[model samples]
Target: MMLSVFILMTVLSLMMKIDNSISANCYTCNPCPTPFSPSSYLVRNKTGCRYCAKIRPDGYPIVVRDCTDTCEFSTWSYMFSKYSYNCCTGNFCNKSQTNYPTHQMVILLLFTIYLFVNKTSTKI
Candidate 1:
């Protein structure tokens, strides 16, 4: 029972740590302009925790933070249609007007650790 309690506490702590790491704000706009300054807002996508900035080959840019449901997850690439997409996780990550690919590896690492701890706690 004590071991279970310890495991549960550890899991809870890890989850709290992960939850606090994400920024509460993100940039959202349609056809975000060059020399852009995007307005920030609290993220509402819940599971759409990723931030995306897509620049059409024509130079029109879209900045938004949403889950995979809203924006299809893809690696950095320019489709034949001449559209380039970049995504990163973190508040305001999409604020950059330049479509440089951003990687949220730290967030992924922490999330993985949280999941592992949670699973171990359940077994306890």
Candidate 2:
């Protein structure tokens, strides 16, 4: 029972750590540069997330957060040259630019779980 409890706690802690580490904050605004304090949005899929801006160089911009390939931002950016686009992942990272994570931690977590299961099976 103690071993089971310990294992459960370890898994729970790892899950929490991964959840906190992978979450991203992005700046969200309908029209950029209008407000001094723009709202930030949360992204579920930290990978392939994007923060896009339209007409930023023109001084009036439309900024959006956590845009996927199916979003209008992707289409607009690909279809036009006037838009400034960025992608990134981190807490409030999109406040400046856009980026993405390689999900190394997720892969590592899966590997750890696999090893744990394999060890348990061997013992049984």
Candidate 3:
């Protein structure tokens, strides 16, 4: 019974260590860049930084990726800039994506129907 208990404790410790493993690399370049992003540059992530950061401003062509000592997940807006700031503990997590929500298309369809109905009723 004592031997079994020791083996169980050893297995649990190994499992805990595996769970604590963190990605140790970060990309120091913007994952995605646009015309409005003055310093947009992208490069593959290598072993780097304590934390990784990506920032994008909504409806504005702004993008940033960086290595930071400390970071947290957050978002904010100022002036003409609506910013989404994301800070992650692992460095290999920054990747560029171009996407649009399907819900926006649904909203557009509804708007078009409303306009058509309003115009037809006015004429009648």
Candidate 4:
């Protein structure tokens, strides 16, 4: 019984460590301009107009239409990292977004560990 408990603890600890590592390696969005425009001169062409271009969170270039001005231009673009691309035509990466399945899995793992520990400790 003790051996099983020890193995369980080691596995749980390893799982948690792996999760932390994955989270650390996860990509993060660099701060960029809002209503990003590739041709707008309002912000000195590039100044105050931080931009990012990279693979979308869903692994697709976001389709964006610019209506900030009278004209509307639509295009597909990926914006994940700042200064990665000269022009952005869609929403940039927002790291605040959470993956429900991953979150649930972590929670479930923690809960299972809790229950296991409790059950093993009780004499009943």
Please give the TM-score that candidate 2 achieves against the real structure. Answer: 0.33
What lDDT tens digits, residue by residue, belong to model 4 across residues 75-106? 22233332222222223222223223344366
Model 1, span 18-100: residue lDDT tens: 64455434454443444565433332323335334444444534433332223443432333344555555555556565544
Candidate 2 clash total? 5
Instruction: Please rank every candidate by TM-score, starting with the best.
Output: 3, 1, 2, 4
Whose lDDT is greatest here?
3
| Position 31, candidate 3: lDDT | 40
Weakest 10 consecutive residues of candidate 1 by summed lDDT:
61-70
TM-score of each: 0.37, 0.33, 0.39, 0.28
Over 4 Å off in model 4, which ranges? 20-30, 33-94, 97-124
lDDT of each: 0.48, 0.48, 0.53, 0.36
Score candidate 2 by lDDT.
0.48
Q: How many residue pairs clash in each candidate?
A: 1, 5, 0, 2
Q: Report model 4's TM-score to 2 decimal places.
A: 0.28
Tens digits of per-residue lDDT for model 2 on 19-102?
Answer: 544534445454444432443232222343433222243343555444333324446554455666554445455555434443
What lDDT tens digits, residue by residue, belong to model 3 across residues 1-124? 4565466557656654543355446555544544324243455555646656667767756566666655544322332255676655543554434223223345556656766786799799
